[model samples]
Target chain A: MTFLRSALVPILAVVLAIASGAIIIELSGLNALEAYKALYDGALADRKGIGRTLEKATPLVMGGLAVAFAFKAGLFNIGGQGQLVIGALFAGAVGYGVTGLPWIIHMPLALFVGGIGGALWGMLAGVLKATRGAHEVITTIMLNFVALNITDWLTSKVWREPGIIVRTPAIESSAEIPRWSQLPTGFALAVAAAFACWYLLERTTFGFEIRSVGLNPEAARYAGISVSRIVILTMFISGMLAALGGAIETQGIVGRYEPGFNAGLGFNGITIALLARTHPLGVIPAALLIGAMEAGGSTMQFKADVDPEITEIIEALMLLFVATPILVRWVLRRRDTSEISVGAHWGDA
Target chain B: MNTLSRYRWWFVTAAFLVAFTLFTAEFQQAQTTAVLAATLRQSTPLVLGALCGILCERSGVINIGIEGQMLGSAFAGFVVASSTGDLLLGVTAGIACGMLMGAFLAFLSVSLRGDQIIAGTVLNIAAIGLTSFFFQTGRSLPSGKTSRIKLGPLADLPILGRVFFSNRPLTYLTLLLVPVIWYALFRTTWGLRTRAVGEHPSAAETVGISVVRVRYMNLILGGGIAGLGGAYLSLEAVGSFERMMTNGKGFVALAVMIFGRWNPIGAWGAALLFGYANAVQTQFQFRGWLADDPQFIGMMPFIVTIVVVAGFVGRARPPASIGQPYSRE
Candidate 1:
């Protein structure tokens, strides 16, 4: 009964968001039923469609885990975009820079380099927050612009593909992550990462310390847990996970680092995290749902003459409903028993 | 000595501006008047956005939805102006749209007691999606630019005329709004009550002040101001709306608010500083120095924002209960 009650809000939020999207479609003189049917068919009907959906879900799951991990430590790391981009650039460089290496060594090296790059980028905000008392919200927002510009410059001038195109050279074959007939290895990696995050956050002593600091920093400090260290380390892990997502995209999907190719993946993480209620395991289904929407968007546009941005509207509405769970409780006529404060530590942190 | 130390950043900025103007031949070679004019023009939306931030934050609501409000207003202004060919009506429509967005934000953050940041983020994402979706539905209106207005006689005054008088009516209104907001925030009784509510809602309620009402009023007012800023973008500046066209000026306004230490006049100064940085980058691009590397030039404002927030600015004290939702219970 408790599990059903807890799950009711998200399920209702998704249903409401889709209903709103249907209203929009109706207002636009399109048949909502037909559009939805087309959307579902495009995302799940064929093997190719399923592959595309899984491919999109892979990065979103990782990005969701990144955000959920940080939330457990009472941190809002909005620099997922920056970390992802930096990781992609570093991983791309390693993928292309070295040659004549075995697949095992080269792939791992590239992934490690990308993860480290993201960790360093994430740690920069962590250190600033821990030492200088700078707000991560502002710092992370600023870092997104910094990352965009730096990566653009690097691609255009430093690693230009010998043409007017602003992208790096194609990565070596040895560094590529192998894809099975229909499923990509990256999807498996994302599922593994989610489980690993769950274990780290729920089973380990360090995870307990991180949770304690999140709950009450003063109490954690009195208990001899270094709050600052945990904050920095949590951010590092969060950033590394996001970077690994980027690395996988470069190694498994794109096979090259192109500007504008990975634009909204990081921002989508915010939506996924909120939808999942910051749960490590919940990230998978939430990511898969959003991924399906994105995968079906183009087909919806092509067949039903609906704009792909309808999907974005649905996602935004879902975020709004989930963020204010009170609205759900009110709609369901349920008493608010346990209040999980999502952003009480926002300014305080 | 204490006073000197307090305004040290101002002194340093002034000294740097003076040094750059006097030493850099490029400043003289490139039309200095043109640069200054551009700086004022660029700062108008920022000034208006900062005022919105000031109003909301002063009333204990943390409004990061300024960007979304601006974007929504910009779209409304452009659509109304295009449909009616009346700039004034378009501007009014824009302000109305902004108020509606503010009301929505208030409903989420204040009534629902949701996370303010999340509410703001949803506003931004929704604005982007709604505007883009509507825009894609063959609703592209004819492009028409708002006419520039020049103040009589004052327009003839030397360099000051070019910098201040020779611009659209909206720009002048934005300039006039700075002092008005400052007076409202510091001198008026309503402002005092608003600040009291922001500082301590329970205490304010004890003194017969309605904290929730004050927040709602200020948030709507701030949204109107931010909407005017957005209208300025479509009607006065770009003369048309594009996808996500307010860019990140709303976020920049947040930085300006922090830089100004939440003061209206200070926000104006910070906006001007950012405007100056933008003008300098444009001048560099115009002179062909940064033509090949526009990305770095595009990065100037964000880098300067980071530097100012990290190094130059001191600890910014926000309103005590800025992000907290108040309830009578």
Candidate 2:
């Protein structure tokens, strides 16, 4: 019973908030039932819609992991956008530009290079935090803009793909990450990445060290762990994960590098990371859920004739509820596994 | 002793590197000077935004919502100035709007001790949505851009007049405000308190400092500065309200704060670095240097911003107690 209650907290919050929003549309003379039905159809009713949701969820999983990894070190890394930008730019560069390589070599090489680019960018912030005591959150955020500007410059100038639309040349057919026929490659990648993150976070010595430092750096230091190095490395890994997401986007969805299309994926990572309670394995479900909301948003907008702003409102309320889970816990008065153990390691770190 | 103390040498290095690159920029345009001036003027909003971040963080508040505050003020400033035709009046309205946002942030993050990041992001989302929905509110007629006023005879002058004072009075004011902000942040007794609170809020309270009060004051003040930046974007630089006039300058300003390493003078240097990038990019475009692929040139600033923040292998230093909400036990 307790486990059920705990597990239901996030689910209940989202369901109720969405219901309330749906009701508001109904009260505003829109057919709430039909609107939700359309949303359902748009998000999951069809194979293609499911594929779209998966495609969206791909980046969220990586972004969530990126943020979750940072959270384990008690660091806020808002630079996922910067990391993602570098990752995407470099990935596209490798994906489309590199030639004369075999299919296997080319595909993995592009993805690996993309992740490395993002990781390097992220590592810079980590090093700053580790050595110079810079706050990663703001530093990363700022770097995001710089990354954006630089990516814009590269795509428009050096990587321009012929006339009009200053994007890169499309990836070669040999380099293309093949889709599962009509199915999305994104979902498979996200699932694999989630397993990788789970193993790294839950079952590894490194994850243990990161969480230990996060909980109490002083104690972790006493235990002879290089706390600063861990902080830096965790953020690097986090960034690498996010970069993988961008690489996947390049390979799976958008085909070529285009500025503004992959917009908000990194920022949305923040939302996904927090929603997952910074849990490693939990990122998968959280990302899928958010992806569902995003995927269904247009349908809800079309059928209900409601503004898409409602989707944002729903997401916000969900965040509010999750962030302030005490309210839900107190109201429901139920015990569960998902209860966020706050005040556990506040000042110690 | 003065040799090590002379930090301007570092500044010189920074400026020289950027200048050398600009010179390397292919085929400088006739309007190169004008573009430089405009770019410097354009960076005013970002500088102001960075200053806001500096103040709030110095006083122990992580103000991620400067982006939202700036946008809110930009929208308000645009509507008011367009209708009123008085830049001063519109700017005042913009500041008030910014202050309101600051107050809310203080109440939530300071008094209520809410998570600063969450509070900020929530505000950002709300600001975007609210502004988008009420976008059509308060228009003189059914339509066109807003009215703008030139500063009159004071606008045309040589040297300091053209480069510094000529463009927009606000642009000049931004430069002047930097020193004042620096002195206030570093030298004054209040400045001491602000730093003390950020470094050790508990210790500050033990010394009879009201941490919450100082944070609240700085929060609102920072908002006002950010508001001024936003107003400059609309009422001065662009002279019209656009959906994303501030663009991601607020975010870039956050970087400048870090690149500057959380100090007033440092912020100025960082802003100049970013401003230099903007100037060079614009100049390159004007000279028809990258006319074939101008879109990529447009991305130079963002790229440079990230690279600069990444800062080789070195790290950036921030205030000791940034991003922590005060909760009295």
Candidate 3:
């Protein structure tokens, strides 16, 4: 019953969102049901659709983890973009350069390298916040612009495909994540990472320490937790997870580092993290749901003649509903059990 | 004097390094200076956003939706400007749009007691999608075409010209705005209260000051200023409205605000530095210095941000209660 009630909120929200979307479509002079049907069909109706859904979910899982874990430590990590870019770039560099290695060695090497690169990138902001009292939100955001220019330069200059567009050379076959027909190796990795997050966030002392630090850094400090160290480390790990997403996307899905393709994905991770209630384990279902929405975005347009942007509207509505749970609570007549320290009050921290 | 008071030396050294790279690179000095001027002009919108950030944060409101607000203005400004062919009307439309967004965000986060970060992020997403949708939908119509307003050679005068007059009206307004805002922040009575409210609203409120009202007013002003930034981009900088046109400048403005330590002078200084990096990257790339591998060259600003922020340890301080949404309870 508790589980059902917890699940009911989102389910009910989804119904309302869908209904609202249908009404908009009706007003716009289209078959509302047909648009929705196309959406579902595009997301999960068949092999190809499911394949696309997983490909979309692969990076989302990593991105959500980046945001979620940082949320655990009460950090708003806008630098996921920076971390993701460096990680993807480095992973691609290794994947293409390290030839003759077996798949086992090469794949893990690329992933590890990507994760570390992301971690290093994140650490820049973390170190500043810890030492200088600069907000992670501001520092990471600044770093993101820097990362964009850097990655753009790298792709255009060194990583460019011969006489072609600005992107890295494709990874060697050995570095490629194995695909199971329509199922990408990246999807399997995402699933494993999700379970791993579940174990780490809900079942470990480190996770507890991170959460405690997030909840009340002063009290956590009194309890002997190294708050500043934890903040920096938490951000580093959070960034690394996000970077892993980019690396996997490159090696397994996209096969190259392209500019602007991962538009707002990292930033969107914040919305996903909030909707997931900041639980690392909860991010799986949240990411999967959002990933499906993203994957089906194109079909939603083609069937209804509505711009694909309506999907983003629906997503934003979901974020809106989740962010302001009071509205949901009022409709449900539930207590204001909505607050979970979204800001986490860093200056005080 | 404080230990490590040689911060200015670090800036000088960094400046020398970048200048050395720019001079020795294939780019000509005139072109480099021209690019710097262009870059300054490019940074006008970002500077305006940073200014808005400074205002709101001073009054103890974290205006995260500056990005969204900028987008709204950029879109509205471009559409109106393109239609009317009048920059002022476009700017007014942009400001109105930004003000609406700001008012909505403030209402939800500040008045309604909603989560500020969540509200801001949601607003950002909605803005991007909403603006892009309209941009795409309007593409079929004539109103959605990109618009521009270049004062031509007015963007190039003498000493004052390169410093101020060399750009469009937006650039001039942004530069002229710095001292006025600086005065307002430190000299004006309202600015004093604004900072006082952010630092300690309880103390401010204890003495006949209305914390909520001050925050609300500052937010609207800040939002309108950010709207002007958006207008600068669409009408002056790029002279067009692209999908997600503001890119990450709003977020960068947040960083610039922080890097500047919430002061108007600091904001201009940091923005100019960032703008210089941007101008240098383009100039170097065009001149073909490290042309084969100029990608990293473009990334120098981000690297510089990291270095700058890291260098700010024990020094960089934002407005007190900057992110904490004020509740009268």
Candidate 4:
């Protein structure tokens, strides 16, 4: 009964969101059922559809893990976009700039560089918060703009391939993450990373320390945990995970460092993290659901003349409903028993 | 010495400006005037957005939804103005839309005691999605520009006139609003009660203040101001709405609020500084100094925000219970 009660809110929220979306569609003079049918068909019909969904889900899973990991440490790493950008930049640089290296050395080296870049970028905000009392939220948002302009400058000026196009050269063949006949290898890596995150958060002492700090920093400090160190380490790991996602996307799907190609993947991480209730393991399914919507968005747009941005609307609605689970409980007429305050550690922690 | 140390960044910025002007011959008298004028114009939305942040944060609400509110208002303003050909109607529509969003935020974060940041994030995503979706579906509207207001004698003043007198009505209103907001926040009895509620809600309640009511009012008012900022973007700045047209200005306004230490006048100053950076970047592009690659130049304001927020300027202290939801037991 407890489990059912806990699950009811999310389920009801999703249903309500879809119903609201249906209303909007109907009001727009479109047949809601036909539009939904097109959405489902595009998302699940063919092998290509499934592949695209997984392909999109791969980055989302990694990004979701990044956000969820930080949430466990009571940090909102809004710099996921910035971190991912730097990671992709370094990975792309390594992928195209380096030569004569075998695939075994090249691929991992590119990924490592990307991870390090992301980690370093993430550490900037962490270090600022730890030392200077600057808010991570503000710092991270600023970093996003900085990252965008930096990447744009680099691609358009420094790393340009002597062409008019504002993108880096295509990565070498050796640097690519080799895929199976149909499946992207990055998807498999994402699943492994998700499990690794789950294991790290659930089965490790470090994870315990992180959760302790998240639950109560004063207690964690009294318990002899170095709060600042943990915060920095957690942000570093979170950034590395997000960076790895961007690197994989560049190597697996995009093949180049193009501005705007990886746009919103980081922001979408917030949705994925919130929808997963900040659980590392739950991020996989949440990411997959969002990924499927994104994968099918174009198809839906083409088939039903519905805008692809409707997926974004649905995602946002889900976030709103999930964020305010009280509304769900009120609609369902359930007594309030959950004591977990999501923003308990918002500012001080 | 303390004042000098506190305002050291101001002096440094002044020195940098002088040196920049001396080095760049393109920054002639006419170019300087244009840049100054553009800076004031550009800062209008930022000032209004900062006011929104100030009002919300002062009342103990963390409104990261300023971006979303601005976007919603921009869309509302653009649609109404284009359809009705009445700028005032458009502006009102924008403010109403913003207030609606503010009310929703208040309902979720205040009354329901939901996670404020998550509520804000949800608001942003929903605003972007809804606006873009509607924009895609709706017919393209007229893109008539807002007529500028010119003061007779004030416009004749050399540099000050160009910077302050000649602008869209919204720009003037934004400037006028700073002192008004400052007075309301710092002078009035209502302001005192609001601060008391923000700092110590239980105590405020004991003193007969309605904490929820104060927060809701401030949030809605902030939303209206932010909506005006958004409306300024569509109706005055660009004459049309685009997807995500606020372009992180709302977030930057939060930084401005912090830089100003949650003071309206301080926020206006910070907004002007940021606006100057943007205007200078535009001027550099115009003069072919950046060779059309203004991307690096564009990063100035954000980088500067980080430096300022990292306590290089001065410490920014938010309200005591800024992000906390007050529940009267």
Candidate 5:
């Protein structure tokens, strides 16, 4: 009953977003029901659809965990895109540049390298914020552009295959993460990571310190917590999660790191984290739902003659509703008026 | 030394501009006016966006949704102009769309007391999605780009003429707005009240000023300014709409606002610096000076912004009550 009660708001938010999406479709002179039906069919009806949905959800799970972890440390890490790109590049570098290692050794090494690459990027923002009082929001955004320019340069100049396409050379066969009976191995890793995050946040002393800082940094500092250390560490871990998502995409799905192919996978993490109400374990269901919508978008466009961009609209609406539960409550006429825990205010440097 | 350090950014910018002009002259003789003109042209939307931030933040409302507001209005302007073949009408529709988004933001951030950043993120995501969903390719403007108007005798001036006197309607308006907004913010009675509310809403309330009303008004007005910037993109600059064409300008404008220390004139100055950097980059690309890698040059503005934000210049102080929700007892 408690679980159900806790779940009610997210469920309602999703419902409202979908309903509003339907209204938008209707207003656009398209059949809302048909579009939705087609979306459902494309995302979940067949084994192929389920495989695509799971494949899409894998990285989102890692991205969601990344953001949610940082929120616990009272940080908003918006540089997921940069971190992911860097991670993908690093993973690609290791996967292609390294010699003839065994499959088991090479794949793990690439993923680990990718995660560390992301961690370093994430830690850069944390260090700036801790030392110079730069806001993570601004620094992360700047880092994103820096990462993009640097990576684009690398891909086109140094790492480029001798071809017309602007992409890195493909990863070696040993580094490829195989899919078993249509279920990707990366998705399992993502699920295990979610559980690990849940355990760390729920039961560990380090997690307690992080959460304490998030709730009240002043109080945590007075209580002998190193606010700066926690901030840096949390960001490092967050970046690792996001970059791991990118690394996984390189290894499991894309086979090579292309500049435009992985766009928005990082930003979508924000939507997923908010939709899950910032719960570590709640990221899975949220990711799966969004992943399904994304995977089905093209099919909806094809079958219903409706724009696939509607999925993004619905996702945005869901974010708004989830972020402001007060609005949702007012709409639903609920008596309870508690707001969701927003970890940090923008005023925090 | 203190004064020199205080005016460090200014000195650096002036020196860089002079050096860049000389360098360009060395390569392409007599192209200084074109470069300066391009700088002003590129700074138009940036200045407008920064002014929008100034208006909203001065009134204690943190609006990170300037990009969304600009993009939405740009799309609206393009769609209306493309369909109706009326440029003025399209501009009106664009401003209206921006104001509508402003109202939505106000409703979420002010009335609902939600997180301002999240509210802004929603605006951005929704704008991108909605614009793309409705966008159709192959739409053309009825005429051409917004024509440049000559200011009589001023247009006959050597270098300054092309750089300032002769420009499109929106560009001129944007230049004019810098002084107008600076006066309105620092001189007028409304500005006083707005500042009072921004710094201390409770105190403003004690003095019989309605904080909520002031915030709502500023946000709406700011949204209109940003909307004008958006319309400038589609109607004046390109004469066609592209998905996410506002790109990262809105975010860059935030850096400009901070660089200017929240003053309209200062922000315009900062915007011009950014614009100059962009203009020089484009020229370099055209001339193939940095043909080996143009990416590093493109990264300069963003990198500089980070350094400035990290207090390489000086600490930028925001309004006291900025980003906080006010509640009346």
Candidate 6:
């Protein structure tokens, strides 16, 4: 009963979002049913389709987990994009920079290095907030640009492949994450990370401290919790999760670190986290739903003659609906209003 | 002397840099004037966005949705102008779109009591999706861009003429807005109420000022300002619109707003500094100065913003009640 009550809003939000998306499709002179059908067929019709959906879901789960973890500490790590970029670049660097290692060693090494790189980037924002009271929103946004420039420079200059293309050399096969019938090992790792995050947040004393700080920092501090340490550690872990997503993209999917491939993936994490109500376990299903949509986007466009970006519109609408449950409650005639609080106050940590 | 003493090193460094650059053979007076002019042009949108931020934030509403407003307006302005062949109509359309977005933001953040940041994120995402979905590839503008205006005698002044006196309509309006908005914000009754509401909405409500009304008005007004900035980009600067072209200017404008300490004149100065950095970046790219490594040059403005936000330069305090929704009992 409790699970049903908790799940009702998100399910309704998705339905409402898709219904409105249908209207948008009709306005665009396309058949909504056909577009949705195409989307369905492309995402879950066969083994290949199932494989593709899981493949897309892999990074999304990591991204969603990253945002959700930060939300637990009342920190908005908008720099997930920057952290992801740094992670991918570093993973790519390790993948190509080093040679002759065993497959087990090289792949894990690259992934670990990527996560550390992302953690460092995230920790930069955490340090700024912890020490200087700089707002994470602004600093993280700024860091995204910095990460973009730095990565672009590295790819175009220092780590450029032979000629013409502004991309790093392809990673050695030894460093590549193994895939089983279109399911990359990253998806398993994502599920494991989700469970780990759940355990950390629900079962551990440290998780309690993090949640305490998130709920009321003053009280948490009074209770002898080091709010600064929690903030920093949460961001560090969040960055690692986002970076792991980027690393998996490099090792399992993209083969090389090219700018723009991972564009909006980090931002999509925002939508996913909101849709999941920032629950660690819920992020998996939320990610899969978005992943399926993305996997099928090209098919929807091909068959329905509608642009693929309509999915993004639906995603945004879902975010809006999830963020403002009051709107949903009014529509559904529900009385209980849940306060969805995430992020820290502006100009302070 | 006391104030000047605080900034003595700034002046000294400025003078030393000018002297150092003057000796470089590549530096010509004409080229330098051109760069200065470009700097003002580059800062037009940024300054306008900052002013918009100031208005909304001063009313206790955090308008992180400035980027969405700008992008949506830019797209609308370009589409309307290109389709209808009327530049004025396009600007109006742009402003209308921005105002609508502002009202939506007001509805979500004020009436609905949603998370201001998440609402902003939604606006940004929706704007990007909607604009890109509707944007056609081969549209051409029938009317040319808003041309530069010559300020009669001032147009002939040495360097100041090209940099300030001669510019597009929006650039002049932006410059005019600094003092106009400063006076309005500092000397007017409405300004005091807005500040009161931002600092303490309960107190403002106690004083019989409608906190809700003030926030709604300010958000709509700020949205219009951001819309004007969008129009400046498509109709004045490039006379064209590209998907996601407002880029990160809206976010950078927030940084400028903070660095300016939420003051209009200070914001303008901060905008000008960023504009100068952008102007230098463009020069470097054009002249092949850092020919082999342009990315570092591109990163300068963002890096500077981070440093500023980290309080490395100076600390800034936001309004007391910012990012909070007020409830009436």
Q: What DockQ does each candidate score versus the true complex, computed on alpha carbons?
A: 0.58, 0.21, 0.46, 0.60, 0.57, 0.62
Residue pairs in candidate 4 whose N, alpha carbon or C atoms collide under 3 angstroms: none
Model 2 residue runs over 4 Å out of place are A1-9, A12-37, A85-110, A127-135, A142-182, A255-259, A325-349, B1-4, B10-36, B80-89, B133-157, B172-176, B179-192, B259-266, B288-317
Docking class of 5: medium
Error of 6 at B271 (Å): 1.1
Name the runs in model 5 displaced over 4 angstroms.
Answer: A328-344, B1-8, B27-29, B311-314
Candidate 3 segments exceeding 4 Å error: A20-31, A93-106, A145-174, A255-261, A328-339, B1-36, B137-157, B313-315
- For B137-228, candidate 2 gives per-residue lDDT tens digits of 33542232333334566545543345555555677678888999999978899999999998889999999999999999999999999988
DockQ top scorer: 6
The ten-residue window of minimal lDDT in model 1 chain A covers: A337-346
Clashing pairs in 6: none
- Superposition TM-score, candidate 6 onto the true structure: 0.95
* Chain B TM-score, structure 3: 0.87
Model 1 DockQ (Cα-based)? 0.58
What TM-score do all the candidates reach, one by one?
0.95, 0.83, 0.89, 0.94, 0.95, 0.95
True contacts kept of 3: 0.64
Interface RMSD, all candidates in order, equals 1.9, 5.0, 2.6, 2.2, 2.2, 1.9
Q: How far is candidate 1 from the true structure (C-alpha RMSD, Å)?
A: 2.1
Q: Once superposed on the true structure, which residue ranges of model 1 sit more than 4 Å away at CA?
A: A331-342, B1-5, B21-30, B136-143
Q: Candidate 1's residue-wise lDDT over A85-182, tens digit each?
A: 98888889889988999998999999999989998888887777776666666777788788888888998988878987779999999999888997
The list of candidate 4 runs beyond 4 A from truth reads A1-5, A328-349, B1-27, B136-143, B313-315
The fraction of reference A/B contacts recovered in model 6 reads: 0.67
Error of 4 at A245 (Å): 1.0
RMSD vs true structure, all candidates = 2.1, 4.7, 3.9, 2.4, 2.3, 2.1
